[model samples]
Target: GGPRPLPGQEVSVKVLGALEDGGLGERDPRLIFVPGHGDVVQALELGVPTMQPGEVSFFLAAFPYAYGRPGREPDVPPEAPLLFEVTLLEVRDGPDPQSLPPAVRLRLGSQRRERGNFHFARGDFAAALRSYRLSLRALDGPATAPPGPEEEEELREQRVKCLNNCAAAELKLGRAEEALAACEAALRISPDNGRALLRRGQLLAEQGRDAEAALVLRRALELDPASKVIHTELSRLAKRQSPPS
Candidate 1:
């Protein structure tokens, strides 16, 4: 270990066993990469700091350092004491999350948005909403300096899209109030956003506010005249408002 592994570095290691009496049983060594600051088993975190590369050490870790109560189940039992024979392989630097370049951050946000779209297509609205929120967080840059006009506009557009997606997910979950807020936030960014307007109108109609829905839907149609979905919604609202002969 030329230099001890520092926080935020990536460490490669081999774990020999777990718990007293080698609870993991006799088996080939297991290799894993642990990001120094990443989520990891507590025992490894405690043990790695003291060991140098190519040094093998045995340590007994109590439940707190192991899986603790309500353990991983079918793997580690509740309140199990763990034993580890560890070998540190190598340490490498990890990227500073805050210092990522703007372009890289935007690309990451796009990836998250794509994941959200995949979840949405699969009808997993909850996961889709989480991914959309994560995308927004990724687009939200560090506060050292404000993004320039072009970058600001790009971020704004991404935020609006994520907000619109969030609204769609919320609507599918029967969370009309949350959906309304998301769509409203998106419209504030892009006032003529037809999708946001359409979602807002749909939510209002679902809540039995047909008149308000009709007004919003009309505005949406103005923004997107070719939207057959908006046209159909308007027709349905009109028919409901019409008195039967």
Candidate 2:
């Protein structure tokens, strides 16, 4: 699910986009952006509007929203252009909470997750774990009522993220077995979850099970090759398996 962008919000966008072979603008935009405020995209109909700053993203965008339609842009040929490669480095929200919907109350968990991550960044492992767990507990309450299509989809996406984060927190706190369980549970919910697979691989390696770790991490790499952390861990695992000099 794509992240939402609110007004007064600034984000860094890395767009590997094209001019569609013909367009009026001389600019073929590329590089990061503190993107100006914008509306919800059709693709973002189920956006996780609670995205935080500094979170990296990679996505594909469908057009005519991606590019102006026929006669709109002289540079674009308008043969049904599609946009590939989009990265949102940061996402911000409006400061005033009253104007926001009640659903945002359910989004507090994400903010707690962010606090947990912040504590992790500061090397306060104990505090980080507390925050992560609290975040999970907060999100556990059953939905008040059945959600609309867009809302249900958004919640599912958020649920996966929460599970993945809890797993990471568990792993960091030396609860390898607990981490494994959390990751597995996440997989049960979303079998192809790359984050769960990646974390489980790390846990397996910590238990001195290199071969199994390699298998799990390899799958994660296939899903997200840009993960430097996973790549580095897999490299170490590979080196450990090499014959002695």
**TM-score, every prediction:** 0.59, 0.48
lDDT tens digits by residue: candidate 2, 37-155 = 12222222222234444444433444534433441244545434444344455554433333334266347556767766665664556656666665565455455454567865665
RMSD per candidate (Å) reads 9.3, 15.1
Model 1 per-residue lDDT tens digits across residues 34-64: 4432234467877787677777788787876
The C-alpha stretches of model 2 lying farther than 4 A from their native spots are: 1-105, 226-232, 238-245
lDDT at 19 for candidate 1? 57
TM-score computed on alpha carbons, candidate 2: 0.48
**Segments of candidate 1 deviating more than 4 angstroms:** 1-101
Identify the candidate with maximal TM-score.
1
The 10-residue segment with the lowest total lDDT in model 2: 32-41
Worst 10 residues of 1 by lDDT: 32-41
